[model samples]
Target: MGRGQLVRQRVLVPLFGDVRGRVISWSSAGACGFKGTRRGTPFAAQTAAGNAIRTVVDQGMQQAEVMIKGPGLGRDAALRAIRRSGILLSFIRDWKCVESRADSKRLYYGRFILAPLMKGQADTIGIAMRRALLGEIEGTCITRAKSEKIPHEYSTIIGIQESVHEILMNLKEIVLRSNLYGTRNVSICIKGPGHVTAQDIILPPSVEIVDNTQHIANLTEPINLCIELQIERNRGYRIKTPNNFQDGSYPIDAVFMPVRNANHSIHSYVNGNEKQEILFLEIWTNGSLTPKEALHDASRNLID
Candidate 1:
C-alpha cells in the first residue's frame, strides 16, 4: 500500500452509528463557553446547537434525529435553532440523566419558576408564539339579507351587483373569492314578481340558498328576497366550493369587495406605480339571469 493509503486507513472516524444513514451532530452549553451558572443557560445552549448543526451541514449532512440529554435551560432553545437552520429533523427524543426520582421532581419544579426569568437573548420563541396565534386559529362569519329587493329603477344588472358588493364590503370578515368574472360561495334567491322563479336566479359558483319558500307579491310591488354570505379570516384570498351548491350551477359575473376592517387593510401597488389599499366597493353581474330575476327568486327563501 502507498503512504497516502496507509494514512487514510489510520485516521480515526467518530462513531455516531448509521443513524438511518444520517449524519449525527451534537453540542452542549459548555462547548459554547457557558461556564459555572451560565452553562445551563438557554443562550449558550442555542449558540452551541447552531454551531454543531453548521459543522454537520458543512460535512454534507442533510437530515438528522436529535437526542437531547439533561434538563437544562438550553433544551428548547437549541431545538428551535436546529429547526430554523432548515435541516430536516426526523425526530427529537430526550435522553435526560436523572440521579433520582427526587432530583427529577426538583428539576421539573425549578423549570416552571425559572422559565420566565431566563431572559434568553433570542426571538425564536416569540415568533413561534405569534405564528400560532395568528396563523393557526381561524374565524368565520355569515351575513343574511332579509327580503331585500333590488330597486326597479336599477337600469342595468351591473347596478344591482354593485349594490350587493357594497353590502358585503361593510362586513368585518373577508369574502373568500370575488372577481369581475364570477363570484364564488355566494347564494341569491328571487321570487314573487314577474315570470322569475327559484330556478331563474343564477347563484355564484359553490353558493346556494338553503331556504326555498317563496313570499307572494304582485308585479307592481318590488320582489322580496334574501342574500346570505359566509365570510372567514384569511391572510390571502382562498377559493372554495361550497357543499350546498354542487349541481353544475354557477354564479353570474360579479366582483368581490374588501372587508371594511382598518386593522386588516392590505396595501398593494396599483398600475405597477401607485401604492393603494386593495379594496373593492362594487360587484357587477354578467350571467344568463338578469338583475330583476335574481331579486325575484331570492325573495323565495328568507334566511332566518
Candidate 2:
C-alpha cells in the first residue's frame, strides 16, 4: 500500500426471498465467509431487513457481485442496501435455474469478461422506479413527461407515484459520487415518507447529502462552502420561461435550458470543466449563496 492511498473494499450478498424461505451468504476481503438467515416470505418486511444485512456484508468485500434469486419482494431492497453502503457493485443478476430443458440445458460454455462500472453510474440517480410486472428487473426514475398523469388505462399508477413520491431520489447519489471523484460538492434538497427515519441514514466518509424529506436528516453546516456551476442556455432557451404561457406544450427538448428550479423541477445538467474540480459547497435555503460565500466557493480550489 502506498502512503495516503485509499484501499476500497467490495462485498456481495445473495438475496433469495419470498420463496417460502430465505438465507444470506457473505464473504470478506481477507476473511473466509459467514452465513445468516431470516424466516418468512421475505416480502416487504424482509426486504427492509435484508437491506440492512446487505449493507453490513458490503462493508467487508473489496469487490462484489450480488447474485440474487427467488420469487421475493426483498430483491430490490437488497440492491438498494448495496448502493447505500458505498460498495460499488459490479452487476446484479438472477442466478436461479429452471428445469424446462433436457438436452439444451446440458451445454457448457466459458467466457470471461470484466465490465467496468459505468452503466451502474445510474445508481448515482436514486429515485425509486415505478414498475408493474413482478419479475427480475431494473428500476428507473419517473419523468414528469411519461409520468405526469397516470394513464386512464392504469389505475395502479396513482398508488405507485404516492409511495415513491416525487423528485428523482438519485440526484443525491449522483452529486455524492461526483464529490467523491472531486467533481462536484453536494447540495441536498429532499423530503418524503418515514421522515423521522432519515436522521439514522449513514453516508460515506466524504459525501454530503441533505435530507429534506420532511427535514428528517441532520446536516452539517460549513461556515463557508460554495458551489459555483456554469450553465449554458439551450438552443431553444425555453426550459423555464415564466413569461410565455400559451397552454400549448412544446417538446421538452425545445426547452433545452438547464437551470436551478426551472419548470422541470429537478431536471438539470451539471456543467463544469472536463477534469473533476475540487470545490467546497455552501448550502442554504430561501435564497442564493451570498457574496462572501460565493467568493469562498470560487477561491477555494484545492489543487494548484
Candidate 3:
C-alpha cells in the first residue's frame, strides 16, 4: 500500500476479549503512527479515541461498554472522547493490577459503576454548591469587658452614644472586609448605661438597635452591660468614615482581623458580679477564608 493509503487506513481500535466472546473494538495512538513517547500523549489518545468512536458509530454501534485496564496517559482522554461522541455509553470500568497470593500474576481489581450524564446538571450543581458555601453559612464572635471605657470620652452622654455608634458601625463594615458577604441590617442592643440608651445609639440607616428600653445608670454605681449585635449576611461593603476622623483608622490586626474568617459559632457570657463584663457577637458562614487569610486580604485591601 502507498504511504498515504496506509496512513489513511490506520487501525485506531483493536478490540480483545475472551476467545469465546465477540470482540467490539479498540484503538491506540501508536497504531496511528505516533512513535515511542508521543503515543502516550493526551493529544494522540484524543485523536485515536475520536477516530475509533466515529468508526463504531458508522458500524451502527449505538452504545459502548468499555473496560479500561491500563494506567495510561490516554485513559482520561479516551473516556472524554467517548462521552463527547454521539454514541450512548453503557458503562466505563477502571481495571487495576493487584498481586494475588494464590498466583504471582497480578489480577484486575476494582469496581466500576455506570453513571449516566444528563445535560446541564454539572453546571447547576457547581453554582448551587458555591452559593451554599459562601453565602448561606454564618459565623460569630463575642467581645467582653468589665467596663470598657469609651475610646475618647465626650462632654455629654449623647457624645458617648454617638462615638459608640460610629465605632460599632465601623465593625459592621469590618465584617464585610472579608469580601464573602454584605450585611443589610446590623442589630445593636446596649443594656447598661442611660447615656448609652437605645435612642441615643445612632447608627447607619441599615443598622437597628433591637432593644428600645432605657436603663438609666445610677451615679453611685458603675454601669454594667450586655451588648448584642447581629450582622445580616449579604455582600461586601465600602468602609465609610466621618469627616472629622478622616485621617485616623483602627489597627487592622486589632480590629479587622477578628472580623475575618470568623463565620463559625461563637458564644460568651460573663456574670454581672464578675470582675469583667463581656461583649458577644456571632458570625455564620460556610467555610470560605481562614481568619489569617481574611486578615491578610483585609490588610492588602487597605494598602491598595
Candidate 4:
C-alpha cells in the first residue's frame, strides 16, 4: 500500500511494497550509478527514489504512502522525488528526536513536538502558540525611578560613575520575577566606592532578581546613593508616559515579556490512512518563566 525509505548517513534505499507487505520493487543510491561520496548526496537519493517510484507506477499504482527512517541529508530530497511522481501521498512518517532540555531558574530552553495533525493544522497551532507566548505572557519590570536630589533624567550625582539617565537605562536590563501582580515599590540604598549590581536592590518578599550579577552602575567615591524604583507586572512593552511621572520621578520604558524568543516548524507524517502534520516548537526565556510554564500559560491563553 505504501513505500518505505531507509536513509543512512552514506546512502538511501527506497522499497516499494504491496498491500500484503510484499516488496515488489526496490532501488538504492548505489544501484543508480552513484559511487563513493556521490552515493550519499541528495541528488543520488532523489534519483534512486524516482527510479523506485517509476517501477511501482508502471504496476498500475495510483496512490502511495511513505515511511521514512533514519538520519540523512537525502530524506527530504527523496520525499520531494516521490511528490513529483504524481502519486497521491496518503501517509508519511519520520522518526526523530521529540524533545531536549536545558532548563534552569533564570534561563529556560525547551523543544516540543506535536504530531498526527492534519494538513495545515501545525502552522495554525504554531502561529497561535507563538503569539500567545510572546504577547500575552506577563512579566515584572521597573517602570519608573525616583531620585531625591536628581530632579531630571539628565542630572548627574557627584559620586556615581553613571549619569541618572544612564542608570535608568541600566535598570531596564535587570530581570526580575514576582508572584504578586500590579504595582510595587522597591528601593536600594548603597553607600558605594565599588560596583552596584541587581543583588543590592532590596526586593519585596514576593519578588526576586533573576540574575544577581547584572550591573546597575558604579560609584567611585563613598557616597550614600538612595534610589526608589516602581515596578509593575504587565504584558508586552510599555513606552514611557508623562502622566505617570511625578516631579522627581522619571519614567523608564518597560519590557514585560519573559519569553525572549519563540518559533516553530511544521513536519508531515502519516497515521492509518490519513496524511498528517506535526509541529516542532522551540522557546527560550530569561528565566523569569520556565519554558514549560510559559507554554502551558500560552496554550491556556489561546484556549480562553
Candidate 5:
C-alpha cells in the first residue's frame, strides 16, 4: 500500500444477539490487544465503544472498520461519533445468526396468488406524454434510464432518478453543451421565477432535459456553473419566531428545525493550473431573487 493509504481499526458492538461478558471488544492492529468494560448499559456501551476506537486511532490510525451486531440504538450512534472525529471507516459487517426448522408451512399474499391481469386499460398518461416527448428528441441524443417498465410504476421512477445522480444535473448538462467554461468565465442571470426552490432540493426524481432558450438561456460570455457544498449536522438555521395567541402566554413544547445543505465543491482547472479560487455569497429574501444579485457581484469580483 502507498504511504498515505488509510489504515483500519474495527469497533464491533452488538445491535442484538447472544449474551456477552462485556459491552465491547476492543481490538488494534499495530499493537494487538483487547479491553473489557463491566457495564452493558447504553451509555456505557457508547463510552466503551468510543474509547476502543480512540485507542486504535490515538496510537496513529487513519481509518476504522466497524462491525455492528446488536439490537441496541447506541451501536450505530457510537460509530457515527467515531467517524465524525476524523477517522475514515473502511467497512461495516453485520454478523447475524439465523436458525431454521424443517416443520413449517409457507404462504403467499392473495394478490401474489393471482397472477397480475395486464389486459386492463393501463395508465397511459405518463407513458403517452413520454412517447410524444421522446419523439421530439428523435435520435438527437436520447437516453433511457431503464430498458423496460415494471407492473408497479414506482420501480421505473427510481431507475430514471439514477440517470442524473447529482443535485443539478440539468444545469451541468447545459454548461457542458455551451462549452461555457472552455475558453472564458460564464455568468447565468435567472429571473421570471416566483420563488426558487431550496438549493438542496433543486433536482427531481425523474429524467429531465436541458435546452438553451427553453430550460436555460445561452450566454455570449463564458458560462461558469458553480456548485458549492456545505453541511450542518444539527441543521438549526432559522429566521423568525412564532408569537403566542393570548398576549404572550408561552408553553414549553415549541421548537424550530434546522435546514440541511448539499455536499458540493466548486472546482476549476483553468488552463491546467488547477488552483482557481471561488467566492461564495448567500442572501435571503421574502419575494425576490436576492441571492442571484449577490452571486452576480461575487462572480464579477473573482473572474472579471
Candidate 6:
C-alpha cells in the first residue's frame, strides 16, 4: 500500500492507495467530525489517520510507504497513528519545496511554538509580544534628504522620472541596518541614463542596505543626481515636522518598525488533571532583522 499525508496549518488529510496507484481510501480531520479550530489539533489528526488506516487494513493492505508534506502540528501525530495501526511501514519521507528567485536574499520568516501554559496565558503573551514587536523594535531608515538643485519636496529634476516628493517616498521603503545608534549622513551621487537603486547609495561602514535592488528612481537622460540623506535608528514611526528640514534638505517621515507582521494562535490539550494551552507564533520581517532576534528583543522589552 502507498500512503500520502498533506498537513496544512489548519487541516490534515491522509490518503491510502493500492499497488497500481489507485486510491483505496482517504480521510481528513474535518471528515472525522472535528469542528472549528479543533480540526487542526494533533488528536484530531490521529483520529483521522486511524480511521483511514482501518479501512485500508480491512481491504488486505499490509506494508505501506508514507509521504508527508507541509508544516503543521498534525504531521508527527498522524505518523504515530499510522504506525499503531498494525501495518508494517516500508518507508516514510518528508517533502518540502522551495521556489527559486533571482534575488540573493532569502525570505525572513520564522515560526515558534510555546506549549504547556495554563489556560488564558497564551492570549496574554501573544498580545504583549505582538505589540512589542510592532512598536518597540528598533530599525534604521532615512529621515531626511537634501539636494542643492531641488529646493522643495515638490520640485522636479530634468532627467529624473520621479519628483522630489516621490523620491523621498521611495526612500522611506528602503530597509537598512546599522550597528551604531544616533543619526548618520549618507549620499547618493549617480549620473544617469540609468536606474538608481538602493545599491547606489554611499553608506558608512557601520550601515548596510538590506535589499540592494530596491528602486529609488529612474533617469531617462544623462544628468548628475546628487542627494544627501540622514539616517536614524529608532522605534516606531516618526511623523515629518518643520524642524526636520534644514538648508536645502527635505524631511521624510520615517518608519522604524523592523517587523512587518506578527500573529499568534492558541491550541489546547489535556495535561493530566489540568488542561493546558500552546502558543503558535509567526513573524515576518523587513530583512533588517530575523524573526528570532525580534522575538527575543520583544520578550526582553517586556521583562524590562
For model 1, state the Cα shift of residue 1 in Å.
Answer: 34
TM-scores, each model vs. reference: 0.26, 0.19, 0.27, 0.65, 0.23, 0.64
lDDT of 6 by residue, 1-304 (tens): 5333221122256776654345677677767888776876899889888887888788777777664434467878887887888777776544222221222352577777655455775687678779988998899999989988797788888889999888999999989988758899899999989999999999999999998999999999999999999999999998998766678888889999888889888999898888877777788888888777777567545433
Global lDDT of each model? 0.33, 0.25, 0.36, 0.78, 0.27, 0.76
Q: Which 10-residue window in model 6 sums to the lowest lDDT?
A: 95-104
Which predicted model would earn the best TM-score?
Answer: 4
TM-score: which is higher, 1 or 2? 1
| Best-performing candidate as measured by lDDT | 4
Instruction: Between candidates 1 and 4, name the one with more favorable lDDT.
Output: 4
Ranking by lDDT: 4, 6, 3, 1, 5, 2
Off by over 4 Å in 6: 1-107, 242-244
Candidate 1 TM-score, true structure as reference: 0.26
lDDT of 6: 0.76
| Tens-digit lDDT string for candidate 1 (1-304) | 1000000000011112132223344444555566666755677767776776676666665665554433434567776876787766665533212211112210111110001101220132223322332333222223222223433212223323334334333332222322222222344455434533233334555433222222212233344445443322223224333432323322222222121111111223445553322311111112212222222112111100
**Every model's Cα RMSD, please?**
22.8, 24.3, 23.0, 16.8, 26.6, 16.2
lDDT value for model 4:
0.78
Q: Model 6 Cα displacement at 261 (Å)?
A: 1.0
Model 2 lDDT tens row, 29-123: 11222223232223332344344445444445434444442234444554665566565565554312221121211121111111121222222
- Which lDDT tens digits does candidate 4 get at residues 201-296? 999989989989988989999988888999999999989986776868888999999999999999887788888777798989988887777875
- Candidate 4 Cα deviation (angstroms), residue 30: 60
All candidates in order of TM-score, best leading = 4, 6, 3, 1, 5, 2
lDDT of 5 by residue, 1-304 (tens): 1011111112233221111212222522112222333333445545655656555545565654454433345555566666766766565543222321212111111100111101210122123222322222111111111112222212322312222223222322221111111122122222322222232113222311222222322223333222221111111222222342222211112111110111111223344533332212122211111222222222222211
